[model samples]
Target chain A: MAEEKKRIQAYLEQLKNKVETQENYGGEITNEEARMDIRDCPECGAGRAYHKGLTACAYCGFVFMDTKLTDGVNIRKENNS
Target chain B: MSGNPLLEPIHGITLEDYGAACARLGSGLSEDDVAKALGVELPVWQEANLLWPERMKQDATFHIVTLFGQYFGQADQHPKFSGLKASASPEGAGNIEKIKQDKDFYQELEVARQVAYDYGLDGAQWIVDNYGIPIGDFQIAASLWNDQIHRDIQADYAGYNQRQAAYQAKYQQLFAEKQGGNVADDIEF
Candidate 1:
C-alpha cells in the first residue's frame, strides 16, 4: 500500500510539473492572418497599413488620403469589403 | 469600512448597469445642466471639467476585482501592483499578526480595499438614483472567492519555498563534504 501511494504521488508530481512547464513556455495561439485580412488599407486595396501619426494614403502620398476633398478628413467606408 | 446600514441588496444589477444608469441620467440633461446641478451638488465635477476619470478608475477597479473573483476566486484578497510578498503562507497564525503589525502591509492593503469599496458604493448609488429604486433596497453582495484564491496561492508558494530550502540545504551539505572544510574557499577563479 505504501509503495503504491508513493508511485501515485510521483505520477501526480510529474503531471503537475508537465502542466506548469506547458503553461510557462507554450506559445499563445493567435489569428494574425485573419487580423491582417481585416485591417487591410481601404483606398489602395494594398495590405500596407501605415498608422504613422497621419491617417493618409501611403502609396499616393495623398494627405488625409484625398487631395480633392479640402476638409482632409478620411471617410470610412460603410462596408469596405 | 462598514457600508450603509440602510442599503438593500440589488439582485443582478451589474457595474455596466450602473454606467448605463449614469449615462441615462445625464442624457436628457444638457452639458450645461450637468455643469449647473453637479456644480452646486458636487462642486468637484466642474472643477475637474466634468472629466470623471475617478469614476472610470473606480469602475475599472470593481470590474477587475469582480472578474478576478469570478474567474480565479480571489475576490477578497487585496489586488497588488507587484512583488511575491503578497503570496505568503496563509497557514501561519503569525502571518496575520505580522500583517497587523506591519505599517507598510496595512497601508497597501487599505489602499486596494478602499478603492474596491469606493467603486462598489458609486456603482450602487448609480443604480439607486438612475433605476428609481426605493431607498435601502439595492443590496451589494460581496463575495469571498477571490480572497480564498489569494490564500490558496500563498499556501502553495509557502510549501514550494519549504521544499526549495530543504533542497538547497541538502546540496550545501553534499558540496561541503565533497570539498572538505569551508565550501567558499574551494571556489576556483
Candidate 2:
C-alpha cells in the first residue's frame, strides 16, 4: 500500500511540473487587403453608399461624387455635361 | 432432371409491385396501362386546372365597374341632366336616345359578363383533379404570386448590385485619375 501511494505521488508531481512549465502560443495578426465595402453616407450617416463612384445616396439623396454611372465594365465616366 | 415446374404462391403480390417487376423485365407498357394494372386512380388532366377562376372573376368585375364609372362620369359632365333618369326633358331624352343608339356598348357589356362566367367555370374540373378543391380563393393565390414576384425582383436587384460593385472595383483607379481632383467636391446634387 505504501509503495502504491508513493508511485501515485511521484506521478502527480511530474504532471504538475509539466503543466506549470508549459507555454501558451498565440497566432500572429496580419493586415487585411483593403477592398471597397458598403460605407455609411458621409452627410446623413443614415443611408449606405454601396459603390465608391455613386453620384448620390439613394436614400438620403446626399451627393457622394460627381462621377456618372456610365455603361461598360467601367461603371463611371466623366460627366462633361 | 426437370420433372415438375416449381410453383410459388402469388397471394401477397400487389399490382404495383408486379408492374415494377414487369417494368424491370423490359415490358413495354404505357403509364396509363401500368396505372390501370395497379388499380391506381389516374388524375384527369385538364387545361383549366392551371388557371385561377377567382382572378378571372375579379378582372371581369373590375373592367365592368370601370366601364360603368367612365360612362357615369361622361354623363355627369353634360349640363342638361342633373342625375341619371329617362324623362321627357331634353337632357334626359337625349341621354336615353344616346344609350338606345349605342347597341355596340350593350353588346360589349353582355360579352364581358358571359366571358367572366365562362372563365370562372372553365378550369373547375382541372382544379378539382389537381388541388382536390373545386376553386381556389383569389386573395391567397394573389398574395403568393405577389410574394414570388417580390422575391424575383429582389434577387435580380441583388445580382445587379453585385455586378455594379465588381465593375466599380475593376475601374476604381482609372476613375480616380480621370476626375483630376477630389471627385466628391465636384458633385452638385
Candidate 3:
C-alpha cells in the first residue's frame, strides 16, 4: 500500500511538471481579419448589398441576379467542363 | 356674426355640416380654400366624436368618406396613381380580383428569386424548372431578393466566438487545476 501511494504521487508530480512546460509546445493562435464585399443596388441606387453574388436589393425591391447566390464555399475549376 | 352658423354652438357637427356652415358665413373663400379649412377641422371633430361611445360607429362612417375623398382627389390629379387607389374602392372589385391573382404569382416569383440568389444560377434554374414557375416572373422576383447570407454568416461567427470563449474557460480551469495558480491570472509582459 505504501509503494502504491508513492507511485501515484510520483505520477502526479510528473503530470504537474508536464503541464508547467506545455506552454512552450505551441505557438500563439490569433484570429484572422474577415474579408467582405459590398455593392450598391442598381435600380434604387440607394441600398447597398454585401457579398459577391447577391440576388436582390433590400430597398426598392430590385432583383440583382437571375441566379441564386452560391451555397457554401464558392470555387472555380480550370479547363475540363 | 350673431346669426352665423359657423360660430353657432351645435351639439353634433359633421364635416358636411361644417362645410355648409362655412358657406352660409360667406367667408368669400375659394372652394379649395374652404375644403382646406374643413380638412383641418375634420380630424378635430372626428376625435371628439370618437370620445363618445354612441358616436363610435358614426366616426367609422366618417373615416370611410374621408378616406374615399382623399384617394379620389389623388386619383383626379394622377390617373396612373388611380390604379392603386381605385383598388381600395368598392367600385374596383374587378381590379381587386386581378391584384389577388397577381399577388400570388409575384409572391411565388419572389420566393424562387430568393432561392436562386441564395443557391446560385443553376440552383435557381432548377427550382424554377421543377416548380414550373413562369420565367418572366423570375426577372421580377430577382428584383425583390435581399441578401441575408452575410447576416447568417455573422450570426454563425458570433456562435463560434461563444464556443471559443467556452473552450478558453475550460482550458483555463484545467490549467489552473494542474498549476499552483490560476492560468488566466498569469500575465506575460
The candidate with the higher TM-score, 1 or 2, is 1
| Candidate 1 residue lDDT tens string, A11-62 | 5565456444432211345666533223334566545353442234466543
Pitting candidate 1 against candidate 3, the one with the higher lDDT is 3
Maximum-DockQ candidate: 1
Q: What are the per-residue Cα lDDT tens digits for candidate 3 across B122-159?
A: 33343334443323223223222222323544779786
Model 1 lDDT per residue over B1-189, tens place: 136211111211222322222332322323344333321212222323222233335563464334422322221121220111222234432433333345333333333333322322233223323332211111111222235435655879786466545655554454334323231343579
By summed lDDT, the worst window of 10 consecutive residues in model 1 chain A runs over A64-73
Docking class of 3: incorrect
Off by over 4 Å in 1: A4-8, A17-53, A58-81, B1-189
Candidate-wise lDDT, in order:
0.32, 0.34, 0.37
Return the TM-score for each candidate structure.
0.17, 0.14, 0.15
TM-score per model (chain B): 0.18, 0.17, 0.18
lDDT of model number 1: 0.32
For candidate 2, report its TM-score: 0.14
Using lDDT as the yardstick, the better of models 2 and 3 is 3
In terms of TM-score, the best-performing candidate is 1
